[model samples]
Target chain A: MNERYSRQTLFPAIGEEGQKKIRKKHVLIIGAGALGSGNAEVMTRAGIGKLTIVDRDYVEESNLQRQQLYTEEDVFEKMPKAAVAEKRLRAINSETDIAAVITDATPDRLEELVQTVDLIIDSTDNFETRMAINDISQKYQIPWIYGACVGSYGMSLTIIPGMTPCLHCLLKKIPIQGMTCDTGGIIAPAVQMVIAHQTAEALKILVEDWDAIRTTFTSFDLWGNQYTNIKIAKAKDDGCLSCGEARTYPFLQNENLMKTTVLCGRDTVQVRPPAKQQLDLARLSEQMQASGYQIKGNPYLISVEMKPQRIVVFNDGRALIHGTKDLSQAKAIYNRLLG
Target chain B: MNKLLFFAHLKDEAGAETLSIDVSGKTIAELKTIVSEQHGLTKIDSVMTAINEEFAEDDDIIQQGDTIAFIPPVSGG
Candidate 1:
């Protein structure tokens, strides 16, 4: 054991034996945003053996405020979040084998990745991805820690396949809707709090300390100074779909999946076509130019600049419409141009 | 008077963290209506309520001195 983890080993709960267990555990973190960065740092420092970070987006100036692993240099270089995070984590602890995959997490990809890891961490910003992760976790019977933060409030829950209620069960009562961080605004303290809770639970799971894992739904508002732990032990029953006896994985079924999502902290909305289609950027740029829209094109993406809005379309039929947060407005532009 | 607490965006919408109201015997649904009317919030029904740190349903009664918190759904990383 390296002296780097001496302090953590001193803690009786994680004494030497727990440290060894942590070094042998493999963790898969879904998002490389604020919560994901914080969780990755903690786990890496604690000597987690291996970690894989997956993210679709690149680092931006706004991300520096809350995302700990990123710096202004990363934004200037247009560095992908997962790659930069992996670099930083490896620097912190070279003993930990860290890998970064820069791509959107689809159900098929997650199903394959979840099999290789002991635990999954939910740091994704959207409910769609979270639900998919829940389905994957339940299907593989792997435990995962769920964490989310917006403004000065945050919440976390640990989902153990057979022992506790899954996220679907909790969502049945408190359906997550409306008021994203882009609209609501977030602070760093709330992000830290949620990640702390998630990291603690992750360590417990890695050490197989089932007794210390919290089964309740915990939420807190730092600005308001209030904390609550709702009893969710009885929330999951035989009737529940994800973790129940029937085991119907609706989120993974590819039905009613959203085509557009408003990106957090960016005045941008992402539109992904339901079915994958290859786009020709040069031809799209030529069409946009002929249509009286100012256009710029690279091999990978085509950018169309209109008055007050810019649409950046990628080759995979995914477009990020800047200068708008409204889903309808973004979809309308995408449909009119791309369809 | 029941002490009502607002959190996250709800606090920003209400413009205060705590609001004291004389709704001792009122149900959570009635209290939501009162708070909505007073604060000009349209989606009061979407917010979750907690009385004295325990999750409370819309039909739960609000007693005197109970700290009622209205929490909006937060889905950010």
Candidate 2:
């Protein structure tokens, strides 16, 4: 009876058997932002045997608001999020084996990552990357929990390969339009709420309480006081371009989506997703101004200057942003642009 | 007359658990218009809807007992 897990093992459902199951399990966690950081701390403390944390960004001063692993020193050092999180996780629970992957979680890399882990957890901020993870989860038959938060709102969903409808099953269409935390401003409490639910679901899966897991999508807005879940037992549609037809629309891997580049020295990145869709630039410009960014545009591209950053958007909704070197930061820019 | 279901943010935006409408339409497209007007949503073109638990096509006809659901572009995991 190790003192580290005595409290958790005391629960009848977990007891000693559940403690052993956790010690032998390996979990993969992508993204080390708000949700990722909090989940890492919670899962590690719960005695998860191995935690593989993958993140592409370095710590920034702004991350301290909700990113649970880093401090001002870590941010000033420009330490990669996975690196810093790994260091801190060991201190929190030295008995657990924690590995930090300091690279972008791309499709090619995903195959290797998924092959070794029993479960995957997504804390990513963008739709494209989440879709990629969803495809990999289905292909590997491993379950994953997706969690996200912004403002006073958050959402969480569990995906269990063949047993449940995949991410695409629920969201047939991706609105390339919506607000992001960076644009809308996020509160830390919302991030904690989302991570708490995601961590609890992971615990259920890890402890082998499959029957108690959530199959439907769950979302809540603490400040706004809204929460709900949608039933998805409906049969998979044949026309679904993803899970239904098993069509792997691996977004960024395809030329159909734009590409992103992180510029050296300038702390900016550029994304070049195919601009096949038309947009209302006039209305978008108006919205940008209303959201506090100064907007300037002609026909080819619209530039939004939001202090310390300059976002150049194209007619097809593609954008080249000059600010923040992290992939999540660039993705956040695109999320705001699309929104 | 049938019940229209909503999910996630759309359900939140709707502010109601479910909405009931009394209208006889033999097709899904007509039902989309009815739900959109009742929900005050932008339009039915960008939104996706299901008829009797299946993704409905523009020409797909709706039966009397089928349950219709309005699914907005999903942002969930």
Candidate 3:
């Protein structure tokens, strides 16, 4: 309607009609890291009616190389990624309603979020969450694009329910413990490659351009100059636990996920209390200050600086222990600080 | 003989992006074992395989002169 999307509307594939369709769509982006930030920015600027972004971590210096939504000030203030994304996206386009959630994207939370959204985008850093999203995508019959990157490699697949093979069908036979950015390192271009494919697919789906949606799963190695798109629509299996004839949706259950786990390539471990609790940040900050702990915080979370380790506590009884991937050490630190 | 290709970390593990190997008549599973041993791709057992750009099923046979690629999934933001 406004001049905001005139350039996009001029594109032959997505004319004024497509732009109007996109304006009526709502997208749910899981994980507010690099992929999440990129997707959120494009969707907002493209004039998507609504965007709900979910992320648990905060901005760190290491993230600046690729994650474009955050700034040095966010890292200094220890602002959560979702909080900063919400602040930044609102400033970018005030018309688009943005809901940035600062919490873990557990299966239960994902199902709740998916109920009101038209599409889901996978920008997460772990298979656990991806599998959950996949199962949810299958269960709800919603379309979602899967994107991942590590080192100089990136890949994407668009999964449409009842039309294409789901992620579970694609990788059902393979053992999934593989490389992460922390182990193999990554480049900014790799992240961008995934964003490009994912954004294109998102736009096509939002505009109801079903014919243009890629039927193949795309993978590439920019450093090696290698690329391929596999036609796996025939790979769909009737026995898939997530999308098959006997659908079990194993990942939808809560037991499959853990309360404490190491973050992907972050050198960090996250710990969540067994039962959710409403933590008072002001009271916690006061108590920490009284105890001589160097504290910095906002209304949503608090940060306590420790030697060689920093603890970030959120209102939902979760803490991210930075500077270590040792699960036990992180749990011990969480107990000591938030107990 | 068959043409073998590797992607992502698989290329590094295999020491080359493409390799021409003599596997006159071998199933995809048998070929996987051979390549995994030859290239020391420890995760080959779990990695997904593609034959000529189509996902190879367990029973798919590798015909002579066919192209194969081993793809390992990466999960990092």
Chain A: TM-score in each candidate? 0.79, 0.89, 0.78
lDDT of candidate 1 over A1-339, digit per residue (tens) = 568999999999999999999999999999898999999999898899999998877898878999999999999999999999999999999999999988778787898788779999998777667888998898998999899887788999999998988887756432322444654568999999999899999999999999999877788988878787877665566777788888888778765354889999999999886556566567557646755678888999988886578999888878999999988567645644542
Worst 10 residues of 1 chain A by lDDT: A172-181
Candidate 1: deviation at residue A179, Å?
Answer: 2.7
Candidate 1 — which pairs collide? none
Fnat of all models, as shown = 0.58, 0.04, 0.78
Q: Candidate 2 residues A239-266, lDDT tens each? A: 5555666565554356644467787777
By lDDT, the candidates rank as: 3, 1, 2
Q: What is candidate 2's CA lDDT for residue B67?
A: 73
Q: How does residue B29 of candidate 1 score in lDDT?
A: 92
The lDDT of each candidate is 0.81, 0.74, 0.84
At residue A231, what lDDT does model 1 achieve?
Answer: 70
Please write out the lDDT profile of model 2 over residues B1-77, one tens digit for every residue: 77777643456557764777664466767766665687754435655566655556666776766777665442321
Question: Judged by DockQ relative to the true structure, which candidate is superior, 2 or 3?
Answer: 3
Q: What's candidate 1's DockQ score?
A: 0.37
* Model 3 docking category: acceptable
Task: DockQ for candidate 2, please give it.
Answer: 0.20
Residue-level lDDT of model 3, residues A1-339, one tens digit each, is 458888999898899999888878889999898899998998998889999999878888878889989999999998999999999999999989999998778888898999988899999887767888999998988899999888889899999998899998988832333566644667999999999999999999998999999999899999989899988977899999999989989888765554789999898999875556667678667657765779999988899887699989988878889999987557545643542
Count of clashing pairs, candidate 1: 0
Model 1 residue A160 lDDT?
A: 95
